[model samples]
Target: MLKKSHLLCLCFSSTLLSGVAIAQNAVIVNGKAIPKTQLDKLVQKSGQPDNPQVRDQAREMLVTRELIIQEADKRGVIQKESVREQLEQSRVGVLVAAVFEDYVEKEGVTEAELKATYESMKSQYSGKEYHVEHILVEKESDAKAIIAQIKSGGNFEDIAKAKSKDPGSAPNGGDLGYVNEKSLVPEFSKAMVQLKNGQVSD
Candidate 1:
């Protein structure tokens, strides 16, 4: 049977919902106290504004969840592999979060520490950026022919705009403006770095 406090928490404040308050600080469910902190989190997660309708809905949901959980525990349904694994995941997730919280609280981040960390991994934030142009084709033979044409005095942009298959850059004459070297594929970046200004890749 649902406790008086449980009904109160699950129902609207009005008598129409059969609500009966028993505790001022917590929702009592099957003689177990569900703390206000945990209850607030549950309500917040419901994504409902703090109004009578949402409050009542959140309460009903929490009550139903508790009842189902209690029934499952009593009947050993939680012992099944799937249920156990689900519960284990929840437990581990909570514990992991708690550990991170505790560690951060104990050894708080300082501006100096942040700067030091940033400096240590500055390569991630700082790199050689490049402006590039390329002709993309479906076949290697097409690429080789295109490269030969460029070598023989074809305008790279005109050729790229006419024949490059990469729709995004093709319209813009294959102009890839100020690319960070690290963002490109390894082989592409290697080839690109070998070229001087306004030089086309072979």
Candidate 2:
């Protein structure tokens, strides 16, 4: 009973309304669905084209990421007590930050208050900054031996890479990079502050 134009309009409106009710899915990876919304957001964030190539790339990335996450979940990675505790701590930190941000937005800070706070804390910031490399060992005897090697023209970094027990820095040749004087332990601070540049601690 409808005219051709009216029938076409009705069909288009029905499709439009249905689109509002249902989210377009981009892919399903191992039963996990990646919605078009996710792809759109990623594309927008990446500033990429909205074309088929970009969409397909997004789908591939989403699938890969989701599978890894699923594998981690299946392995009960999140079930460990330490991980759970850390996760709870991270959640608490985020919530606290959000609440603090909201409070600051609602109850604004005055320039005078900021100035007073800065004045009260300014003295805490001053300390000698040391840029040095260190090779740590369990025993003082071992440390002395390493220092002797360095003095005898052995490469400090190569020695550190070979022998430092501090796993994080050992791979990078025992570089602690720059550290402030107060941030170190009392013994280390005292020893390091007195050392001239290129001097190793004995």
For this target, which candidate reaches the highest lDDT against the unseen true structure?
Answer: 2
State how far residue 132 of model 2 sits from its true place (Å). 1.3
**Residue 193, candidate 1: how far off, in angstroms?**
0.5
After superposition, candidate 1 runs with Cα above 4 Å error: 1-122
lDDT of 2 by residue, 1-202 (tens): 2365673221111111134333777666666666778878988887876887987677667777777667668779789886788899999999999998898899988899889989766654565578877887999899888878889999999999999998768888999988877777899889889999887776
Report lDDT (CA) for all predictions: 0.76, 0.76
- TM-score on alpha carbons, each prediction: 0.42, 0.59
lDDT score of residue 183 within candidate 1: 78
Give the per-residue lDDT of model 1 (tens digit) for 1-202: 3565674333222122223442332355676555556657767888877776776676666667777777777778888886788789999999999998897899887899889989876865488888898878999999999999999999999998999998778888998878877778999989999999988777
**Highest TM-score among the candidates is held by which one?**
2
